[model samples]
Target: MQENQIDHLFQQGFSLHQQGRLEEAQVIYESILKLQASHFNALQLLGVIFLEKKQFIHSINLITKALQIQDNQAPCYYNLGSAQQGLQQYEEAIARYDKAVAINQEFAKAHHDRGVALQELQRLEEAITSYENAIAIQGSYPEASWNLSLCQLQVGNFHAGWRGYEWRWKNSEISKTAGLRNLKQKLWLGAESLQGKTILLHAEQGFGDTIQFCRFTRLVSQLGAKVILEVQPSLVSLLQNLEGVSKVIARGDPIPECDYQCPLMSLPLALNTDLNNIPGVPKKFITCC
Candidate 1:
């Protein structure tokens, strides 16, 4: 096929993708590969399409081919890294992300993805730094901020982490509800301590996060304040036994007056959590209260 014909096919594929005709786009991209087997753009885009289709291995193969043909293409490495991540080949994904970052230090997506791979590998501290780098490089990606916060929590840098985690409210999946206080409250920033006041911790994230962070109520309450826990139904029974909790309520319900309210994920930020001071539960998070 002529160069122009191949380019036209590529453009058509891209248009289809933009129109959300992913299967049609993939077919065209694959056809471009048949005409020009080493076509860099075709392979790279097809790799991305495969990734979207959840065909991780195929995406990896296509992206690796594209990378070989165009070693300098940052997007190729990013897509390759993503494909590797989808396949749970975290080390390899991190390596690809490293290459992407090295090629373009300002590549915010690369740093974000690398942090994700590091997090998956349990390299918590390093992951947090990578996430911070991503935020520094590009402040627009909400997931980067949210993931960084979780990483900080994992490493016990609670204060910074919880603030980062609050980006969850911006996520499409997170249900937004106006708390007693404004959603813009600084509870995660620990701008004010809970000393001599009521602190309401509204549940955020999954059930497991509520179970894990409920332990912080004991410390918060012990500091001479009441700790109100806004929890999910599944976790309420388990959380009632956690020390320091004065009350538990379901989400979206109006609660009693409190001096401060924070998301459950923000406990780390409020307590300045770190490896030495993670909010952990020593006893059963469930059972006799």
Candidate 2:
């Protein structure tokens, strides 16, 4: 009978999870947990479910309870760190990730996650090293590489950061990796003379990135080229006067043929931009999402 009840609880939880109702699934997991405190699966599931729901404290509590039952569980520590990250408890998250890495030095994810927490706390250099360690342990995790590049760029390592930042284009979220109607596909690594070339630079990722990279439109134009920038529609009017930009093309227009293409974020590295060389922009690029 107890086994049947546990099975039923699991089924309910799985059904709710499949339907994307994490809160409801958590309640069912909690009910099963009350009857069987030592249920490891329920414990871990509830912890992760709560984490996904952004109930940071509750997720920490559930994971910590799991840790008490099984002190050697590396995943619990990792999950605990993730919960702490959501709560913006950087120090505690670092401690939890430290324990997880100590238990399993080869745990690349833990190192990367700790780096994210450190980066959030403004420990940029330390975060870079942590990301490097993660790369050493397991090379080329797209998320880690993307984040490492951000930390690098934040600290003015434009050369290295921009090179590494290219990995972001491969992320599944980037929809235009496949060829568009008429634009040529290229990495934009300081190549393809911008002189007289009609370069189409397509934007990728968040609003901040578009704004941040928009400064390059002027740079590209300075090279004696026509710039057709494909950016977010909302940013169209805002980017009208960015330096050197010949045209702002938001969606729906037939993509124009260009001699070259560049990911919006790739220009800084291609140009070897630094603190002194970093292009200044107006209020449009300065604003955040």
Q: Of the candidates shown, which would achieve the greatest TM-score relative to the real structure?
A: 2
> Per-residue lDDT for 1-289 in model 2, tens only?
4798799888989899879898788888888888898887788879898898888898898888888888887888999999998988899999999999999999999999999999988999999988999989997687788889889878867777888877766555443542233444554668667677788887766678788878777877888889888887898899877778878888566778777777777788778776556677444454221
Q: Which stretch of 10 consecutive residues in model 1 shows the poorest summed lDDT? A: 280-289
Please give the lDDT score at residue 108 for candidate 1.
93
Mark the regions of model 1 whose C-alpha exceeds 4 Å error after superposition: 156-159, 170-199, 218-228, 234-247, 252-254, 257-259, 271-289
Prediction 2 global C-alpha lDDT: 0.81
Model 2 / residue 236 / CA error / Å: 4.9
lDDT of each: 0.78, 0.81
lDDT, candidate 1, 157-229, per-residue tens: 5556666666776655543531223544345346666678887788766677677767777777877778888
**Structure candidate 2, residue pairs in collision:** 218-243
Backbone clash count for every predicted candidate, in the order shown: 6, 1
